[model samples]
Target: LMEEGYFEPNNESGRNRDVYQFLDGVAAHSKHMQQEGEARRLLRNLIFIFEENDLSQLRNRISELILYFKSQYPGKKDLPYIQQLKGMLREWESDLKWGHLGFNAFHVHHLRLGFYKGEIFTETPRMDRDVAPLLALMQQVKPTIVTVALDPEGSGPDTHYKVLQTVSQALRIYQEEEKPNKLEVWGYRNVWYRFHPSEVTTLIPVSLNSMAVMEAAFETCFGSQREASFPSYELDGPFSRLSRKILVEQYQDIKCCLGREFFNESKHLRLRASHGMVYLKKMTPDEFFQTSRELKKSTENIE
Candidate 1:
């Protein structure tokens, strides 16, 4: 908006005025922005600040932001190897954050079967073509276990549901032809949803240090989603922050029910008294199908 003149600075006049100047220029005072409704509006409007950065532009913008912060505000603290930072923010790594993960990353061509609004279910042929390579990958790997997001009904942004359907379909075909002897489907939830203790088969404890790692990884890896244009209304920041909040909340809830002593005195003290716990539901192929089928029905009805 600043670049496009939809917004203007209060005192600054340069075309490349940074965010602080932009806020001052527009008189977006902290007192004014602190109002709940106004804060939400500002958050939503600013979420997609990098929505159209075609890789190279995204990289450039990251550099620009760093430089803007460094040279312009080279205070007595905070800085880094500016040239070293340029590579990551530009990679096509929306999913896999770390550059090393690229060693195993496979880009499924034309796999983005839907747009922002989610898959409408009318694009069957396109979806089928996209799912073909995935099935082929399964055949080649012959993995015994697979993990998938299990956001029910209205939990996630529509894409997770679309992916669930696609993966489920591929799994069915793979099982039918390959006749895999044993396969376990592990369903997990993140910021979009949660599973009650009774609903989960296992609780994998997350370390306090791991929580810090998660935050750092997110803030570093997802430069584009820093603004997360279509962020959840529940929070003003990125989904990573929301996920961390959810995890902490879950830990507190567990402490209440199981008693804090159970954690603090457990043999695995570090893990037991950790920041969060992962809820996992393990199922056979048939059971996975049942759960997914129910979720599919609910999603379609809602749609």
Candidate 2:
């Protein structure tokens, strides 16, 4: 090829010396390896080299090497080293076995590095004991309906949905020991949110005061007591409105709307307006967002 001038020694085609060096190293090591362990080590080194150099050509080289092995070894049982390396290489090519290569490694590395340096992934953060305010508010209001609205403008395509899913998951866990109230979700414009108060006949727009009250409830129960800030927005009297009649007209309607069947009077407890504040008092913001985002992301991604 070089004699035909199709390639050159130091031109663009030759600029990637790392590939040649790696191939040469693999060839030299493969030739001298007599023991299975040594062969396995060389194969691992080649894989590392390919990964480090981003040499996609290594994939083709892998195929060629495997073919060479089959031709040379001819199903010999003594070839333990070749068999191990071959099995691993084959596993890497399989979608089910190697599918995690796309994201899991990055996720794990990010988590590990965050732990080492004490940094947070804007995507995820740790929670501490601080959620007392929201719990208190919940106890006071005894709101059968709780609405969680994510900022439409600030959210990405999947972000809003994930936020709602996170909230729902938390609700599920919170109500595991006791039956939960009927929950409903509303998606409009770009906003995704949930409304609570299992028996609400209509949704009255939540007021600034109501949001403040809700924020306080959330902070006490689910956020840092110092300052649990949710997204801020301009609002007037009745910040939110929903038809309560739609929520509890029938169990079928509820199931079709929310995809959650929490309506059995025996299995699900009704929210008592008087006892709401007491219920809210039990909340702590320790793991509010920390445990939810990943779970939410995973949930939405799968769906």
Query: Residue by residue across 71-159, what tens digits does model 2's lDDT show?
Result: 77322442444444444333322311122123221111111111112112123212211122333334444444545543321243343
The lDDT values for all models are: 0.61, 0.33
Error of 1 at 41 (Å): 33
Relative to the true structure, candidate 2 reaches a TM of 0.21
lDDT of 1: 0.61
Candidate 1 residue-wise lDDT, 149-245, digit = tens: 9987567666676677777888999999999888999999987888887888887777878888787667644655777756777788987788888
Q: In model 2, what is the error at residue 72, expressed in angstroms?
A: 67
